[model samples]
Target: MSSKSLQARYEAAFMPNYGVPPTVLVSGEGCVVRDADGESYLDLIGGIAVTSLGHGHRGLTAAIAEQAGSIAHTSNLFVNEPEIELAEELLSLLGGDARVFLSNSGTEANECALKMAIKFGKQHGRTYFVAAENGFHGRSMGALSLTGKAAIREPFGPFAADVRFVPFGDAEALRAAVGPECAAVFLEPTQGEGGVVPAPEGYFKAVREICTDAGALLVLDEIQSAIGRSGAWFAHQLEDIRPDILTLAKGLGGGLPIGACVGFGSAATIFAKGDHGSTFGGNPVSAAAALCVLKTIASDGLLGHARTLGEQWAAELAAVGHPLLLGVRGRGLWIGLVLDGAHAGAVQEAAKAAGFLVNAVQPDVVRLAPPLIITAEQARSFTAALPGILDSASPQE
Candidate 1:
């Protein structure tokens, strides 16, 4: 079908939340996607950082197929094999003796963490929560309450009371905000949705100590940074600090939907019988896909690939010396091209027109989170094409 026809169908059937982009994607291979119009584009955003292994990964498909054929879903009532196995693998990767609560998406995982924190805090007569400003958690009620973006939260106000926002990357501000009255400190090691910003040096370690001293749980929202996206299993690992609660999703299941709220130490023992539940949270098919994603990332040595390739791409893009470019930030496959001008949206549209996919995460920040399987050559192609893309998007002065 034509892109216009498919768009018309989509408009007729779906809500107008996401205004339809020009192209309607049909299929994908590796890091490239083909639109309905038979044009291929390097999908650098990778389904907004969800497709870790890129499109049509055989191992992911096979795992999903095998698990679905065997047992697609068995509610939270009965334990399933894939869920158990995936939990074990995730705990092992985290390098901690942690318990996992499976859910359906990043927001759900964060919601689980929030509930856990609230329950845990209530025990100690605490109720307030601390989160970083500009931090993006999910759109769910509880998660949105924890999110620090005012514009996103204001529209859906009457959010949970007693939630506080501290400036991100400011250790002193975080220290001041987290106190005995604080239930938990929810933060992202790197602010992914806030323009791919990583925490300053020693920031997380400082926050960890602050939360510890305040008797508050430190919850790291790694939905966009975990599962090898940041060239590491988790972004906080770079600092070697362990969080009381860690929320994950996005690339965890590659393209499948799966989320996990992992609790460690005392936090793991907080939730008891009748505490919380999700019917199709850890369905076998999604669990199987998640397991395959983790295994494939390790076996294929994608972590090292992400680190090296990401560093090279950033350096190369910086070397381009574009007049409108500021610099680059982020680690591994997750990157942000900082623009000197407010032309990120125009640049994103221009890149799309030139057969590339990127995200204008902020007014002046372009987020690039390609698949972990993306080749160095493919990355270079995008970087090489970026200068012209920017030039085309610049104001015709």
Candidate 2:
């Protein structure tokens, strides 16, 4: 079917949670995707940062196929080799003696982490949660309750009580909010949906100290910053501060669906048998795909590549010196191009017309999360075209 007809069909049949994009992508190779009209585009957002190795990665496909052929799934009732292997590999990369609880998405990982924190809190007679203002967690009840965006959370309330939000990047506010009554303090290493804002220097160190002093668990939501998206295995690793609980997803499974909540030290044993379980949490196929993603990243040195290219890409874009380009936020392939005016939606459309897929995450912030496998040539092509794209968009004065 043609792109227009497919979109019409989609609107007619599916829910309106996500408005339809102009293109109906049919296939992809590496960082490029072809729409139903056979037009190709460089996917700069990389399926919202989930397609780590990009489309049609041979190693990932092979791992999925091999695992599916042998053992595609195993219920939590039985053991699975791929699951075990992936867990061990993840813990090793995390540099912790941690236990992993596998799930299917970032929200699920966060949910699992919440459960651990609540359980741990109950044992200590604490019942409060401390999160950051403008932080986005997940849509699920518990996760949403912890999310500080009031517009989204207000409609969903009466949410779970005892959750407080402090201004993000404000160490004093965070210190005041977290204390003996708090069960856990959840914060993202970098705020992805909140316009790709990074934590200020030594902010995490202060948070760690506060959580430690308060005897509350520190849950780092690394969903968007983990799995080599930030040039580190986990973004928190760069700070050298260990969170009691860490949630990961997005690039974790390359393109397949998988997420995990890793618990360290005492938090590792917080969940007892049957405390929380999933029917297909750690299916062999997804586990295999994750394993392959890790292997390819290590062997290809994609982490260093992402870091170097991200720096170069940011510098090139800045050097373009476009009037509409205000500044850049974030690190690695995860970037937010801050525009001088409220024209991000128009810029996104213009970029799409110019054979590029970027996300206007906020009114003036364009998010770019290209695949880890993206070449310098591919990135440069977008950077070279960015000025024209902005001109076409016509930002307000």
Candidate 3:
């Protein structure tokens, strides 16, 4: 169907939650997508960082097909080989002996983490959770309670109680907020949905210490920063600290949906057999797909590739020398362009016109989370087109 016809059908049938569709994408390959109008775009957003291996990745496709043909799902009542293997692989990647609870998305992973935190807190007589301002965990009641955005939370009144908000990147403020009453200190290693902000130096360490002092669980929400997006396998690895609970999603299954709540040490033992469960959480097909993603990332050395490309892309963007370009922030494949003015929306529109895809995370921040498999040539193509995009969108002097 044509883009307009599909859009009309969508408007008539679908819920109005996401507003109008941006474009009706017909197909994709690697880091490029073709819209219904047959215009090909360099997809830098990678479906909001979910397509880790990019579109139509052969390994992922084969893995999913093979697993589905063999056994798609058996529910939580029966143990599945693929799910067990995927869990072991994820724990191995984190460099620790940890326990993993599978889920379907970032929100569900966080919900599980929050429940685990509450259980841990009950064991120690604490009930409060400390999160950072502008931080986004998820939209579920438990995760939403920890999310610090008022606009998103205001509409959903009476969330899970006892969540305290502290300023992001302010170690002192976090120290002041985390006390004996706090159950967990929740934070994103690098804030993705909140304009790609990274916590300041020593901030996470301070949070760890504070949580330790208060006997609260230190939970790191790496849903957007994990799976080699941030050079390291996990963003927190760069800081040399281990979180009590780590939540992951996005790139874990390449394009398929999967999330994991991994717990370390005592946090690992908090969830008893009957404490929590999900029927489709560990579906064999999704778990098999995730295993392929992990193996492909390791065998292809995508971690080093992401780090090198990130530095190269950031340098190229900085060299554009546009007055509106303020600075660049974030690590590895996860990056954000800080605009001198609130021209992110304009720039994004211009970029689309130039056959590139990007996201304006905030009024002044443009986020880029290209696939781990993106080539240097593709990066250069986007970088080369960016100057003209910026020039076209520049405010009239």
Candidate 4:
């Protein structure tokens, strides 16, 4: 079918949650995608950082095919070999004896973590959860309650209570807000949706101390910043801090839908028998895919590759010296370009026109999370196209 016709059908049949579609992407290979009309575009956004190995990675494809051919799914009642291996690999990467609760997406992971927090709190007489301002957890009622954006929360009236918001990057604010009544302190190591902002130095340590003092769990939402996206197995590792509960999803399955809520030490034992479960959680196919992604990343040295490429990519962006470009922030392949004004939307459109995909978090912030396997040539192509794209987005006087 024609792209326009497919889009029309989508509008007529689907919900309006995501608004009008962008382009009807038909196929992809590596970091490039082809539209229905056969136009190719570099996917810098990488499905908002979920497509870690980019589209149609051979190892991941083969793993999925092999697993599906053998045993696709057996539900959570029966323990699966792939699930066991994936959990073991994840725990090993995190450098801890963590028990994992696998799910289908980031929201489900957060939901499970939140429930575990509540259970942990109830056992110890705590009830509140303190999250950072401009922090985003998920859209579920429990996760939404912890999210800091009031505009989104206000519309969903009478949400789960006992959740408070503190300023991001402010150690003092976190220390002041956390108390004995708090069940957990949640944070995103690097705020992906919040303009790719990183916490100030000593913030994670201070937050960890405060949570320890208050007897609350430290939950780090690493859905966007984990799995070598930030040049580390987890972004929190960059700061030498550890979280009691860690939520991961985005890149874990290498494009397959999978998420894990892992708990360390006492936090790991909060969920008793029948406390929570998911029918499709830890399905063999997704687990096999995740194991393959982890194995590939480790064996191919993609973590170090991401770090090298990210530093060079940031340097190139800095050298561009576009008047509208404010600066670059973030680590690894996850980087954000702050614009001088609210022209990010225009800049993104221009980038798309130039055969590259980017995202505007706010009007003045554009986020780039290319595949971890992106070569230097692809990075240069993006850098070369960026100046022209920025020029086209010049502000009107």
lDDT of each: 0.92, 0.92, 0.91, 0.91
For candidate 2, the TM-score is 0.98
Candidate 1: TM-score? 0.99
Query: Candidate 4: what lDDT?
Result: 0.91
After superposition, the stretches of candidate 2 with alpha carbons farther than 4 Å from their true spots are none
Candidate 3 Cα outliers beyond 4 Å, as residue runs: none
lDDT of 2: 0.92
Residue-level lDDT tens digits of model 3 in 189-239: 888999999888977888888888878899999999999999888989989
**Residue 134 local lDDT, model 3:** 89
lDDT of 1: 0.92
TM-score of every model versus the real structure: 0.99, 0.98, 0.98, 0.98
Model 1 ranges with Cα > 4 A deviation: none
**Poorest lDDT segment (10 consecutive residues) of candidate 3:** 153-162
Query: Cα lDDT of model 3 overall?
Result: 0.91
Question: What is the clash count of model 3?
Answer: 0
Which residue pairs in candidate 1 have backbone atoms (N, alpha carbon, C) closer than 3 angstroms, thus clashing?
A: none
Candidate 1 clash figure, as a count: 0
**Pairs of residues clashing in candidate 3:** none
